[model samples]
Target chain A: MPNNGMGTLLKTPTGISGLDEITNGGFPKGRPVLICGSAGCGKTLFAAQFLVKGITAYDEPGVFMSFEESPSDLTQNFESLGFDFEKLKAEKKLRIDHVRIERSEIEETGEYDLEGIFIRLNYAIDSIGAKRVVLDTIESIFSGMENMTLLRSEIRRLFTWLKEKGVTAIITGERGESSLTRQGLEEYVSDCVILLDFRVIEQIATRRLRIVKYRGSTHGTNEYPFLIDESGISVLPVTSLKLDYKSSTEIISTGLPALDKSFSTGGVYRASSILITGNAGTSKTILAAHFAMSSCKRKESTLFFSFEESPDQLVRNMATIGIDFEQAIQEKMLLIQASRPSLQGLELHLMVLNKLLEELKPRTVIIDPISSLITIGNTNEVRAMLVRLMDTLKKKQVNALFTSLTYDGQSEYNNSTVDAVSSLADTWIDLKNEERNYERVRSLLIVKSRGMAHSNNRHDFIITGKGIQFTTSNKK
Target chain B: MKENTTDVVIIEDKLELTLYISGMSQKSMEAIRNIKWLCDKHLKDAFELEIIDIYKNPKLALEQHIVFSPSLLKKLPLPKRTLVGTLSDTEKVLKSLGITTEK
Candidate 1:
């Protein structure tokens, strides 16, 4: 346990990746926090991670009192998440007490309190000197008892006893129809409360976590999407809302000398986001390939996310335009990730991108035709996801290039999907194909470039064996 | 699991019962008094009663899954039954324990 300062409250680190960032530090120490959710939303897993992380990372012993699952079942379930319950128990670092209650086997005659539970918990905690506790779905006790008044009172007392004992505890509950929990367990453990929601929108399932209440602390109030993989739970915090990312003065070439000359600075700023919007045959992907090739030429690792084309397909197609991506792929300076937009939920895609970014430590990233991702989520959700993606890239000081496909007749200024990234982009390039003399002529325009003087005149260009070449009249 | 060997009077019997209490609290005393009276009046010497104070042995509480204090467990009957709380209702307690009273 550690405090941010002298006057700040003590906090326990959860040790789950990305979770502590949103929680500021972690849950309040030496207090009971309620984690309520519907069936199969990962409440049990969250509590288990809290205790297990406490033991392995903080050297604190823990007690797990399960009211639903048996001890064997709990051990087996947590084993998949890399937690060895038996080993921890053998070392006297963890104690699991399974409280089995069957309503049909009991007949309530007169009056009684839950002294048995208190004594058992006390004995277990004292035996191990546990500092962390998890009562997984303690509300299940309500199912085995006929007296609601007595159970509620006993539960209130149990929380008080836990606090008095000076152990940080997590009490999980089932989601209620009206209140936060079915039995209103939130009414008892009120120090801190978190709600997990599992929702399927448009046939794509997303798990979200929200902090309903956290007394005496400042925290992220937005609903953060989380993922449960083999490693454990990792919450994706909606990144810095303030535009405070560091700026870089270094410029990076676009691999096309003609295109570089179009900007006043001769090249785009390093770590800046660039957007390329064009119609079907306007060569948006080709332009993005040029950016990736330039990054690879500079010996900086580049990550390309291809939504519509596979890696081999992209390489082969780019080769036809005199852009040799095969050499860069072989040199290991470029990594291309190809996946369909419908392959998984939006959050999973973001997680995969994050994992790759962390592992590769790439200096530049490209998403070819980001418009395909719009099909997977609603307008607002897709916008939010892109905003988070851009913010993450900006924070890492990684240059990002995104290509968007505009419909033939849809104005680039009017398309909602393109507008989403265009407003946030530091540089915007619009490409168009028009019929002139029964021949399709492709022209490029620099719509807007922030903090730079760029050519606003349309320059007709053509895809040649040497890549994109500006027509003679437009060249300086 | 059968850890109450201290206060057991006899092993072989038609009715084998274990009463789990917490430090002779008021509820535990009432439950002990009521169960003793019912067993003596109904079964006479055919029953064996074992009283366990969980305060002395708290591990047994978890082993037996005793959530509520003053729990009465009938072990010798074909179908075991658990009754929680103080056994103040004599008729209901006897009837639930499979002992019939003449009308």
Candidate 2:
């Protein structure tokens, strides 16, 4: 396990994709972690994924003591995410114990402790030599039992026994209105507490996860946005990399020869971020498409994220400008991921992009009109997300180009999206449509290019059938 | 099977009960004492009780779907009833078994 120079607290390294990074390694090893959340907030899924990942990735056997769902239901639910619990159980690598307590069937007679649960868990753990254990929503026992004092004491004992047994455990509970957990289970499991929250801001559902507390271990305190998809729960720990990403001096063509001549390096830095801001229909997507095509022409893979247009529409529309994205896509050199900005939250979009970047390993990534993402979140959130996105792209040494649509009469710097991205970009290009002699004349200006003496002249550019053609005249 | 038949014969014409416990915890010990006292005072030798530790015989506990410790299961009665607790409340225990005791 990799410790982030913060004391030598032994960590467990929960093999869930991005969770370990956020936890600074994982849950404190051999200690119980309380995961509390409201209903439908993915608490159970997070716990299940933790155990499943433990078994598959770490080769550590796990025991899942579920008080809410049955064994079959759990298996079926996780099966859709590609976790075959049945097969894991058959191999003796996993144990599923469903402790059902019906209020009607169970009649409490006198002073009793919940030793039965302990026995069952002990038996299951011993049988498989499990190193990971999950008691899904153990707070259900509170509703089932009438004696609060005995239940509370037994719960405390259960945590101590788990620590003595030396297994990493996840005990889930329902979130309380004022307290961390409904039954105040947080008081018992004092080592670590994680809160999962699901909220709808502007009618868009966003799931966020926060590490409320982790004793003796340093962890990221920010609320990380998580997503539950086909692969399971993925908590996107934004930009775990430091700012020491190696910048490349290698120059790459922007596909427009005359426009490329405006930069001192003759082209953009290989891994630097480029921002192109212009009003709508100023061929922002066209410019982005040309960059993608240029990368594909060099045999380097390119990923084009089109938020406004479908892949087919983008392909057909770009074909009119003599840029053939379809050929590049068919050649497997270019991957176009077109999605509606309203389909999911901005964090999910970033997560999807992160996943694609890992799987595709593209050399260049282009997002057409990043301004559209402004609708999905507040200004600050969008800016933070973009900063993390840029950090990730830079760390991977992938050349990133983002196009932003500035509203009419608003300067490129005045646009919030452009304002946020320009500060992080290595090169900024401002495009505008100027009405000249009853004709709509398009012009491009190099706003700023770091580490390069770029031409500041506003040159007229024409979008013809052969893509963008820049005039040599420096006149506006 | 032979032992089970012999045990049933001994429990004949009496309230046959099995108490499932997990090890010798205080609660389990208390349940044992309470159930014995209840049987002695209420049934007066008319009830037979067997205490089984689930930790020692976990398979039996799972086979019977007995998930709670300190649970009293009445086996010989026509309608079976399971009351889970330390068995400290003699009145509640008897009432759960559908037995009437002298006030």
Candidate 3:
């Protein structure tokens, strides 16, 4: 949807990370955008970030008119986010005007309008030559005044004046029970509307942002998950909408020489996904560790996400199988990230993985027992999350290997996670344990290998001090 | 020293008032005209008046808690009162300010 030559509406970049990309550029330029949300949903933070980023990133001066908080309080609150309001004001890049209206201080006698606020705002904007403006929760004027008709007309005039001033503005409003804003400010601001929602699903609180309307520009309509950290708000856009990834033809080993010989190409495709499903103690983590070690041996970066074990525990336990993750980590070739599955929701887990993949740029990623994620979400959510994860990894050309656990007597054939991931993965391997002569014997089988012929027979394997060993000879 | 004597006379009357307004808006101008006319007819030579444009002195607006434009503040004579709107209703303004107008 390219807007070529037909007088595409210009947009002012909101410089918030990932927000500009979703809005296709940003809010409609020189127009007022209404952001409405319930209490403590980050509306004020979003507005502040927009103004601060305008000053720092785009070299645009801004004015912040707060109807609720004082200038000193605002400066003190945003100081934690590293926004030096004092410094910005000293440099003449920012101005803050606080409009204090007490209901008990004034009496309505006759025909009055809200011209004082408009005059103050105009003065602040003109004083700094601001290119951006934010009116945080202007609906307080409705509560402070007794004349509804005059206030409404004055509010309407204020919005029109903002547009005529030719400066990009953000107006934050409190969410109402029925309407988008408590005062229905959304009706006055017609250029764009964004809604922020915070909810607790399964006892984990997650913040989501959605663009309700954009008059003339195309935008992402889905609810994008956003995180508030030390750097401020970041919305994670789903990267799976388009399937335009370039597939690689290079082959990479599966760590075991015998396992590599099973495939016709002597290895898996470079950027393909591999899923390993088995019962408990069937050496799934051991196989994943071996794969990670092989990727590290090639001098390529690898990220290992462990859900059931701590990093120290994984390092110590992998040492029993002769896999030296400690050395690889010491050499700066491997990064082991371990987190509890119940700590956050499935989407946050995916976001963390996405964030790690972006920061580390690992050539190979291994998630030890992704089945633990199923406990945090329903079947469909986990499936969708995995699909998205796989798409992101493939688009980044990062080979991924995931392990899943099956219950006793369920077998890898009938498990739910196996059914979900086996089809999505390009290479599927199953490990099983059987009782023979009062001992549990482990075996491996290549269930399905895409674009290549693979061995169909199951090979007996053992986990010893030197990693996994195949009892049979390498045979195609 | 004529200006000083006039100031002394105004202070002797003990009636001080301030009008907060935006610059030259129609409603503000009307309010100013109406208030001056009422002051001349009712309190003649007994009250002192000051006009402030909030656009030029926004900090003063915050200090006085001026929410609406064309607001009149009766600052003197204790028990302060505020009247918001164009001062078109002379009777109500006089009653709120405890000023007895001669009919």
Q: Using lDDT as the measure, which candidate wins?
A: 1
Model 1 agreement with the true structure over A141-231: per-residue lDDT tens digits: 8885678998899899999999999999999999999999999988887789999999998899999999999988888999988999887
Report the lDDT tens digits of candidate 3 across residue range B3-103. 23222122234578899988888888988998898888667777889999997898687567676888999887766778889988777887666665332
Better of 1 and 3 by DockQ: 1
**Candidate 3 CAPRI-style tier:** acceptable
Instruction: Select the stronger candidate by DockQ from 1 and 2.
Output: 1
TM-score of the A chain in candidate 2: the value is 0.95
Chain B TM-scores, listed for every candidate in order, come to 0.84, 0.82, 0.84
Fraction of true contacts retained by every candidate, in order, equals 0.90, 0.70, 0.70
Candidate RMSDs in order: 4.1, 4.2, 4.4
lDDT of 2 by residue, B1-103 (tens): 0123221122225788999997888888998988887777666778888989998988677567676678988877656778888887767876677665333
Between prediction 2 and prediction 3, the one with superior DockQ is 2
Evaluate all candidate structures by whole-model CA lDDT and list the values in order.
0.89, 0.86, 0.87
Docking class of 2: medium
Instruction: List, residue by residue over A28-142, the lDDT tens digit for candidate 3.
Output: 8899999999999999999999999999989999999999999999999999999899999999999998877656546676788877777777777887899999999899888
